[model samples]
Target: MVSVHRAGALLNEASCFLCRRRTHHHLRFPTPGFALPREASPSRRSSLAAPFGRICTRAQAMGTESYTFGPYKIHPGEVFYSTDLSYAMVNLRPLLPGHVLVCPKREVKRFVDLTVDETSDLWVTARNVGAQLERYHRASSLTFAIQDGPQAGQTVPHVHIHILPRKPGDFEKNDKIYDAIDEKEQELKETLDLDKDRKDRSSEEMACEADEYRVLFS
Candidate 1:
């Protein structure tokens, strides 16, 4: 178990993730886990939840922020994913109208840090979303790309597996598809009001953004 002091040091020096800036503080020291103290035993405790309260409080005090990747907006929320996990979200920025993201509920910086169960659950969730995409959009295939760090193009420290639905005409000419998509996303960001205050823009507006991208690619 890591000590509180050590945890603090680790969190502070963390990188900005996407831009390599120092501004993003993605790591936090987990609360020390130990057997319950004698005084917190059920015999004296008023509630079973009390013993776990300190750990929860410490984690919350660590502070966190939300991020958007494509159409999915991730934060602390219940029912965020169709999976039973408490956090995660469906993709709003779909490559083929049904792409999704399968991510962990915790703030793990690297894919190697994921517990065996966490990794398994992530794949299961991706498969589930893939099924949905196939049923809804008639996708020919799905691509699950999991990049671990900077060299692999991981923008956020938190590990996320992008489940992209593949279609027949999604790509035809080149392999630099991601660069093209990122450029179009930026163009939409500039022209549309996707700020926190104006989060949800109409589908018509999104379609217009798509038209702008189609022109660029064409």
Candidate 2:
């Protein structure tokens, strides 16, 4: 079994099954003097039209602001959209090309743990995010899943809704995505441990993707 220990405010260590050793994973931290990519100019935001324009307008009317997800803050330029109760973010390990997570601002562990307001906001946010992702990825279908608890395959303790954009024939079997989700973290860990070239996506890369999505939803 793999065990994880929170090492500090900005890092965590997880035991590896292969080497029986611990590997430290750096939490996403703001880099000093880090600037947005040159290509991430404000004009980019105007190019990709948001499919769910009314959703964005509604969120703005609610005076919704960004919040923190784990250690990372959900900034306006880094998220597709957000409401007062929940926000959607780019996934670190995307199950598909356009997979993202919709999470409540409150750090709840299960779906049932959400407050009535949060529950409503979560699905509404998911729907908007899903629509945007489908348009962005030109997906034929979408998968909105919630792994309610650990027994139900919730890897991270936080309550997050998975919005996966799917294409026809993306997999030989339709249910393969679930198996892929179950094994993705472990597979990435093993690859990272043994193959030095196979590193996790850099913070810059993630921010870049987020920027693109921000543009798409703008």
Compute each candidate's TM-score over C-alphas: 0.48, 0.61
Q: What is the Cα-based lDDT of residue 53 in candidate 2?
A: 21
Residue-level lDDT of model 2, residues 1-218, one tens digit each, is 33343343112111111111111112112121121122333443232222222111112221346566544454453366667788887665565556788899888877888899999999998888888778876777898887777687766667888788876655556776776666653443344344344245443444445654665555
* Candidate 2 lDDT: 0.56
* TM-score, model 2 to reference: 0.61
Best by TM-score: 2
Candidate 1 ranges beyond 4 A from true positions = 1-80, 84-88, 178-218
| Global lDDT of each candidate | 0.43, 0.56
| Residue 199 alpha-carbon offset, candidate 2, angstroms | 2.3
lDDT of 2 at 107: 84
